[model samples]
Target: MSHPMHDVLGRWKAAFDGHRPGAMAELFTEDALFQGFGPAVVAGQDAVRAYYEAVPDDRRAEVTVLHTYTVGERVAGGFADVTFSDPTGWEAKVHMSLVLRRDDNGWRILQYHVSRVAAGG
Candidate 1:
């Protein structure tokens, strides 16, 4: 059996790898705050959808969960290492952090942030 973190990230990974931007956005809350690989941070599910819509269709991501913690009955947060690659062998890595909240709809991402991974780190 998998934990909530795995359940959520597993779905996220599938959506991202499958190039389903809309499905990716569905993983977040309506008021989610997102800072993807872009320089700008955006809020709301609409913006999250827009941000993911810019991802290259051939690009896929592999996320390794580094840590996760429960803040309360309704909140949880996690850290992960994410590697993105395409068919051409181009790759990028990032340290990702996320906060999720539970509602009647299970867990939804409330905040998502990513930082470029340093060389040799």
Candidate 2:
């Protein structure tokens, strides 16, 4: 079955793989909080765009949706396991989670975070 979250993630994946930083930012809310692979967390769409812009153009992301949820009719969110790969075959795996809120513009990400998925403890 298809979910709204799937559609959002699908568009995100397309933008990411295409290295369209501006396009990716459009999916996020104006004040969205973001934490990519960078050290400090940033806020807002401009920061989000800058973060993606810094990523290598050849790097592509494959996301596996691990879970999803809805908070009433105005909010929804999900967790995903993502593998980012480059032309040289180098890859980085991480766990990502995002929350979205419905507004006049439709569902836009309110928060987006990424963290390293630890290896065997």
Candidate 3:
């Protein structure tokens, strides 16, 4: 049987790959916290949606889960490698960490952080 968390991540990946910012934001909690490559942190669903929608349409991402573990009956954490690609063949890799919490609707991202991986590292 596949891990339930895998399904959650899969949905998240699909949303990103499909370029559906609303769908991506729906995977997060109302008050979720997000930090991308920048130092500024964005909070809440609307902000998250706006942040994702701002991503260039020419870019797409592939996410690979590196590790995951349950923090409690309702909380889990994981790490992933995210690769962003554009039509010009430009690519950038980022390391990501996520915290999820289960609610009546299922697991939703509570906290997400991503940082760019140094080139040639």
Q: Who wins the lDDT comparison? A: 2
What is the descending lDDT order?
2, 1, 3
lDDT of each: 0.90, 0.91, 0.88
For TM-score, the strongest prediction is 1
Give a tens-digit lDDT track for model 2, residues 58-82: 9999999999999998999999999
Clashing pairs in 3: none
Sorted on TM-score, best first, the list reads: 1, 2, 3
- Candidate 2, clashing residue pairs? none
Better of 2 and 3 by lDDT: 2
Pairs of residues at least 3 apart in sequence or in different chains that clash in candidate 1? none
Q: For model 3, how many clashes?
A: 0
What does the lDDT come to for candidate 1? 0.90
Point out where model 2 deviates above 4 Å. none
What TM-score goes with each of the models? 0.95, 0.94, 0.93
lDDT of 3 by residue, 20-74 (tens): 8999999999989999877999999998899889988778788888998897689
Which candidate do you rate higher for lDDT, 1 or 2? 2
How good is model 1 by TM-score? 0.95
- The segments of candidate 3 whose C-alpha lies over 4 angstroms from its true place after superposition are none
